[model samples]
Target chain A: MRAIWTVAIASLCAAGLATPASAQAPAQRLPSAIIMYPNILADGVFETRIEMVNLSGRTQDVKCHFLSPPTCNGTDFFIRLTPNQPISWLASRGTLGTGNFFVNAPPFNGEGSLKCFVVPDEHGIDHQNAIQGRSITFGPDGYTESIGAIGIQRLTPGEFSTTLELDGDTYAQCPDNYHFTFVASEPGDPATESELILSTCDEDLENLISKTTVVQFQIINEFEQLLSAATSVRCYDRKVLSEINSVFTRDTLGTPTGQAIVRGVQGAVIAVIVDKFVTPAGAPAVAANEPALSRGRPARIRIP
Target chain B: MSGSRLRGVAVAVALALACGTMPARAVEVDQVDWAAVLRALGIALDSWRLSPFPRMTPTPTIPVPTATPTRTHTPTRTNTPTHTATRTQTFTPTRMPTEPASGQLSFDPSTGIAPAQRLASALLIFPYVVHSGSKDTRLTLINMSNRNIGVNCFFVKDAGPVYGCLEVGFRINLTPLQPFSWFAGQGTNNPLTFTAAPPFDGVGELKCAVDPDLPDLEAHNVLQGRATVFDEDEGNTVAYGAVGFQRLSPGHFPGVVPLDGFTYDQCPERLHFQVLTRQTGSNSSIVLTPCQQDLLTQVPTSTTVQMQIVNEFEQVFSSATSFTCHSVKSFSSFSTLSRSTLGTDTAHLVLRGVHSPLIGLVIDQFQGGPDNSTHTAANDPYLEGGKPSQIIFP
Candidate 1:
């Protein structure tokens, strides 16, 4: 009788508590109305290929902005997707469609980030949560890697406003914390190194005002020994892991793997990591992974 | 004692033991092969209903205190050495051994589900893996918590005659924060070469699960992994993060684990991908594996995928294809996906398993003009609308 009761109670708990948190909130892996690609590089040797799709059953109009570093200025473009249309373009060459569907100018060079959103139409932006995108960076030596664009869906769609709220009420909130894991690069091993790219969630494209925030990092090695580091990111920034702190190197940690917990001190940020590894014979390989998002906070994206 | 009173006492004692001595107990029985025993029982009752067994069995859990404070750090302007001072603020691992250093540890205590790919405890799937003369895939796995974790992995062969679905199983112990990596051809060096079984040139999927033998720790979603495929001669490489599913329920894990958002998170119902078609002188191939598997019985499962293709002009076309356990579908094979038919260089594709859920990546190879001969890039498609599925583990 006791066993039967425990089993029965456990079954009820399993049925009631099975709904995932993602059902209530948008996840990075799913399609959304807005998407952001934080790492876009086109520096001669490497170029970025942007791909996008409309997952809805109706036509959708999308507006995109490319923000490059140093100044992090914005360049705007327009694209019209008929129902489930898909599109692709090289960041360096830009894209020109048949009619008004095109980019005004060459929107990319060096390195930066790309953000896109569904424009308000008669159908409203509510049904426009079908935009899915990816950015693939490829080099001449067959070195290529890709990152899924972070997708944000509107929680409550209303009258069109320049200020897009990512507060879990208007849209999906920005993650307050990001968990990054990587293998420590060996000291003198020209083969292994990782690059970290970070983009702030707060932006003002209408005014070209980039949000600069200080990011705090708490790192732990295989031994559970903790280390800390900090850096300031304006708009978008990229840096080698060891440049922020030498502890990321295997020689310093005395371990092959380490985990870094990152948080923005002032606001929120999204991050991606690209790793390059080569064998002893000089064969090279590269891969990219996005940090896991935990917690959530409000952020605003102001656009004209 | 009455049944209800006895049950309450059992819960209290279980929580006390879990909070106090979980790590020590995990190490004490590290050598046991409990999965093998379960595999034997699963084969004997292959057709029997096992869902009720997992829920009824009592599993110990260490309840995390509700009001754990979120840690805040001082923002620094530059990369100065003083930034390292925050290391001294480390919180000891006592109250919550499995809690990550993040702000909120939101997880289902009954099901043990974490967000997809974040705190994945149940399974990690590398949908595409290749090993041959010109190419090799390297796998990297990491443990994210403060305690050690044991993992069991399987290499399911995708190409062969009768034994195409053959599985080669192996186990490894991951120290806290440890990152393990090895070439698919070379396998792990420490435990000898545990590469793919018969037929040296093989391609398929790699699935890793938290070792069920570790008492009270079978479903802590603290593992994360990634895979990189690179060319040996040309150095062409592409990498992707492994798809992870966190365990939803904690107890005696059943052989047939349902991915019905109750026992585990549901598998994605549809996958969205965009790629450059043959019109642009580029080729794209998608490697896919079904979410439903019978590793215990070594039986393969097949699912048909319905694809909706949309060109740049908003023109839509539909097609369907079927495959067994694993398959690599090329865009050129389908007329609807070609540049000549679609009249566009690139197209957007949405794929759904007719009867089940699927996971995979799209790999694109471009032909460069001058100094560069060729290059490849790969990325995971966007997933939408999850559906219930099941995995029969060995």
Candidate 2:
């Protein structure tokens, strides 16, 4: 009788008729927020820096668009990035990893209509495949042929970095409020197939699941001072490193850290640091292989 | 000789007297004794004179009745009388009167109408009126007053029938001193014409009429009409009119039965209206009727609105600004809006912005389809549509 029951269960599984209780349950979605930091340059221009992180185990990709105040057009101050693209920088101990992207910033046009987006990566494209399970398929002759896995990192903690320069003289001439938005997503696969022990199949299955994050900051001359005195660092994912650990290893090279930090300005220099690593004591840490520290070089940005 | 003879006679008489003697002789002897007594008396008198002086005493002469009358006859003296005459008289004169001077006459000065007021009277249907098709459809203005008058006209939209219209400019003559009676249309065809009215006698009312078909000689429906009457002699009288027409056919009617031109005169200022029947459909005739009033009280001033867009990664940017302005005579209005880019992210993105004086304003409408490809999906993932924001005038 037990053997007969086992056969029945296997038949049910093979026919794609069986479903686990967990599948019917609703999935809890995570909340995300974005912060914008603006730095004023000497040439009367402005540079903006952002950091985006995933707070949930699900990985996410974020896109940002900036509009001048009076008219919020998509092309105004817009930036697109893949899952691995860094949104800001990180500082750990005495070491700092500056962001690589450069954004041109003008004075706020006075409309106060800026926005951004964040998308989840359930397939591990933003991180490595280690945190998620990998699958391998063999040919009919028994020779191993293909290997694949969901590439998204469930980043409980992550970090991103980038810089923008704003025209200070222009800002002085027209002081205005800069509005911004940040969106988050947790995409899932819609074409996922039930596994058969002897069958091999490859499918492209990804859907967009997203949320929005919003923040506002005034453009003033003393913006850098406000950023330095901030107590809690604003980020989309405060524990972004944990989410990255689910899909990629600590030593993974070129993995993008997605985090966002927003700072207000009154016309001066502003710096943002996004760190994804944590120490043994559970404190934030900078990556050990950062280029600035490894090459023993000083990183300085001058705007004239 | 007489004395000797007398002496001889006396001697003879004395001798004869002595002889005759006695009394008679005494007399003759007295004569003789007189001489001797006289001598003796003379000697005694001389002796007596020595004692004084008793001077000669003369005896009184006798009475001789002498000739008084003889002296009077000889007196015949000539007497001459002299008389002088004096005369007295008076005189008088006359006078006259004078006169005074004279002076000239004067009247009240005329002021040009405001561009807004003119536009309010001219372009009654603004953006709704198709700007194309009839290039001959220009603007016309008329002043009903005998005295020369000046005015301006304009075009506007958005604020409904009352206040949204804006001014384009004024229509002043090149020579300022010369009183302008009429203005030609802007284009060669000159669809619209403006003229001053003839002066009325003994009345304070002036009628201004605008004829759209004047130069074209084509009859058209009047779009707007206004009239002004000076209640008092020193008051103002203004009149204005606008012309437009709705056709029964969709296409141009080369030769259709023309309708009688509508006439609106002696109307008051500050009147606004919309046409009740604007379009002509199948089996339906277009008609012009007065619509509602007080739709919009005042025109809008400078103001603005804002909007935002976001991507998969939480990054943001922005743009903000205002519209353009135009003026005609006494009215001014605005159009066009603009702004700059703002955000911390530095990546390629697209944005679009727009504004319309007719429909107010709308911001940021995402176009195209959702980008779900693996490459683009890996990049951006958000969509927004419709008017993302609004701006209102203050």
Candidate 3:
């Protein structure tokens, strides 16, 4: 099949719909990238399928690791993609279950996005950002929401982590800090979870995901006062953080209005995605009369 | 939005297939190998270009034959080509996914139904009935940017005959990351009072233009949005995404900004889609939205789009119309197509604009069974976006 395509190309240049390689402008090269999907769900029957494509000219050896343990990639898998090649899988599990296909990732009970930093396979130097990806949530309710991934230029060695080699000759780098902000949610409002992914960049097993950092969180209410005791996530193996002493839910008999801050230590940064889970079963039916409650609700598309 | 980029990928497939640069079909099949055609569709999706920045589900790929086939019949079974030196070519099951006389559709992962990406210029294709019961499209536009943005939003309704005018649409300023939500057909209660913008709320797509007033013309990729469609029956709720196409800088084009509009870097000249329905048991349809040529131009531009639907038998049933900016056309119910010769199972729909470009038009199948059980499977139309650089309106 490929051989025939090659001959056809030669004939096409003579026929002319497409400009010959020499005549056409040079194609854009993929850049060194820090591709992140803010939210990945693998809870119960729900799932998050991720699709990644490599449009670069050469093969790209990219490493992927989750911020926490029993990570979705199964201890961070490395994949090599040729130009224009696309590889997709379920983030929770490395691959899909039996014929229940159509899903790239399994139902990962957790919620947070996947973070990938693009670098040359052989050479550690950052490569052009050429990889693009998208993540979709398959809620048991049957509604499919396609939230594609976003690629931000990888942080320079100076902006985030230093070029550090933790295990073997393989490289390990981490962002020094990350801050997440979202409008406050009230009680009965679908509880909101601020999931931060801090993956193991190290590629060795003897190390067994040993790098650790203190992620201190501060909850500040609309009144600008501390709502909860100063709490910190103490761990070396937590990939995603969805509970800060049940911070996602409102305390006290009434709903509270405030924001929380999670400050990571130097050489300990991660991507944060805040999901407003549609009110859970048996939760309070929201009081619809007050217009104030609707202010910070997550924005969604409608059929107009 | 990735619609233009999706179109870009589609164009590559069609071009490669057209010029014989790539496989006319990936594997030679005795019949239309639905699975083989479906798998190759994602082959050209460059990870980096998968609807850059803010688009998803690029366009319904232009089917390119992956093989210089021993047979020459089917191509909707195609996409961008991949030239591999040595590879394992899996022979998927020849039988198509099982489909009953009616009720449901269990689709393949790559069915082109993934929610599409959002862009500065987008269209939310869905069904809306606001007459006796409550059926309205609640449109939401979010300015992902932290900065305030000025947007011109239109809620167009299908009048059965033609698309209503942009006369009722409104222009509002959105605050940093603010969301402008409204109930179409039914007036919204947001920045404005109880007023439903014109093409006054029937059932159709929504068009949003960023930076309506321009010299800077800076409002192309800054907006991302979606639409929650409401149907007559209470349980009829399907979340449809608005696919995006970018607004290129005037500089991309020499003087004039040209009437047809500068074709996108990844735009395709044509597009194709597939449709299905089992008798009247399924209500299958495809909605076609027209990408604006020079959207802001007060001088209305027009283009003729020839849309044809061909069934399994190779019989053709088509419709052609000239539309200005902000108009949409829909081909409803393939099960009962205009040409009965095409039969009842599946139909191939092709959309070609004489001058402008077609967006990611859609085809959805909806129905209610004997037990009053309602099932809906709507996929973003499989669009093959292929066109010259400019999708000029006039």
Candidate 4:
């Protein structure tokens, strides 16, 4: 009887250990940083492109939501992209989320939405697979898109980045400030942990990432000059994630994590710089000395 | 003695006869001559006869015839001398006096009695009645005759129809050469007087032109007579006539009053006569009577009429009152109100009346107030009692 009793106590202990305390206590959510490039472009046919990267340790499908933030309180953000641009998609791990957006750019009426999706493989690794992704586009009609399941590469654990090449020659120049927002979500369920990422340069290997980042481009002197560059980036841990959700949900019934990018040219400075650059170039001078290297060789000299 | 004493009785007849015969004889010598005488006597007796003295015998007396013839011849010579002396004495004058010759008379048989020439005639039109208490009368005399004549004006209370023998008093003296003119005089010394009732029965006459006290014949020759009667019981008197009186109105005598200053009361209703008697005819005719209208014709109108108002002191009073008038047909009636104050507090409120382009009336009252006072009662204090409280007119 004593041996049988002891065995029963052990079984109880095993069963108790087998069941989860809070069902794995939802995975910790990572922070996100947004990078934005602001510029004044010449008029005519033009093209604009934006590449998103995931810098989180886990592969992240970054969804970009374009909006007029409170800091840019009075502006209206409306961008046009090629193929009517899908606003929401899934990015595979370790890759850039490239979009070729046209800048004929329909008129923007204020607010828009972007959503991303990431689905993990059987081994719990995030993948850019078609069956496990989801996305939708939103804005005014004809300017709104719902491109479901766009392919996106997932970022590796350490550093991730991308570049945006905007072909400005496609459309007429527009003199106004532009703002962009990017957000990332974990693979699988949208209710799972999500993060927002930010960067200044078009490549990960070139620039550093912080809690927040802002990139401003001034098209002055027919050349783009960086004016005010500032941003805010955040580092997230499991404790911080849990604390945020607990405090937010307990107080307001939801967890809200946001990233804001404020970038624009100082119009006064740009006008002065552009005027200096666009001035006509003088004629080249004739060479004072001729080289004797070859029987008929041309020499080059600098204009005084 | 008869025959020498009776022939002596004879004896002495015989003796005497003897004597006688002797003487006769002596005479007989003479007798012889006697016989011649007897012859002559006889011739004489044929021419004449002689009467006997005492003897009774006719033939016996014949002897004496011779004697008678001789006596007659002597006496005839004596009578002729006496007749011549008497004729001479009767033809001589004794008393001779010195005196001027009498004037001669001319005869113009062709002309009849000369037309009666008007001597001096005067008309006394009294009481023009310019305004109440204001009187203006006139005495106008015309010397139609060429000769100068003196005139004296008189007033008679009860002059009968014949002004002659009427008791009159002297008022004015006018020279013969000059026409008589009388205007209203100032002060209480007016020449006329006013009475309540009409038919004043006042008669005026031009008495002796020469004063009775002055006896110079030259002066008397220039004298003339005139008489007038106030007719219609009006307030005026006029003198006009020849030597006698003519009734202006039967038993109607007008009253008379003196006019010191010209009053506007006598002005026409629509028109006013601004001329003084000195400037106009003494007997001017007006189309419209003073203060009255004439339906026949319009009076000459004037915008403003100049008038003189004199006070008791003979001072002219002009600043006391102002006048305004309105027209009625050809005439106008005027109303007078007090003027703004004169310089001093002691103002002369005496003003008879004003003459405008309208009728004339007396200025009964005048009042004054301060400059700032504009209320009717305050400014025109005379109206406080309803009837003008002050009297400015005569």
TM-score of chain B of each: 0.66, 0.18, 0.50, 0.22
Error of 3 at B53 (Å): 63
Candidate 4: stretches off by over 4 Å: A1-304, B1-35, B42-152, B158-173, B181-209, B212-214, B225-394
> What 10-residue stretch in candidate 3 chain A is worst by lDDT?
A288-297
Better of 1 and 4 by DockQ: 1
True contacts kept of each: 0.39, 0.00, 0.00, 0.00
The candidate maximizing TM-score is 1
Model 1 lDDT tens row, A1-304: 5456555655544543342222112356654778998888887778888888776665667888888888888888777776666777788887775432543335478888989988757433336466778888877556676788888865443555678887654566777777777767764545478888999988898888887899898887755678888998998998888888888888887666677778888888888888776754576667776666566777889988
DockQ of 2: 0.00
Q: Among these predicted structures, which one has the highest lDDT?
A: 1
Residue A186, candidate 4: alpha-carbon lDDT: 18
Return the top candidate by DockQ.
Answer: 1
Q: Which 10-residue window in model 4 chain A sums to the lowest lDDT?
A: A270-279
lDDT tens readout by residue for model 1, B34-106 = 4543444454445345555654455322121112111111111111122112211110110011111121111
lDDT of 3 at A276: 35
Candidate 2's docking class is incorrect
I-RMSD for candidate 3: 17.3
TM-score list, all predictions: 0.74, 0.14, 0.44, 0.15
Given candidate 4, what's the lDDT at residue B139? Answer: 29
| DockQ (Cα-based) for each candidate | 0.19, 0.00, 0.03, 0.00
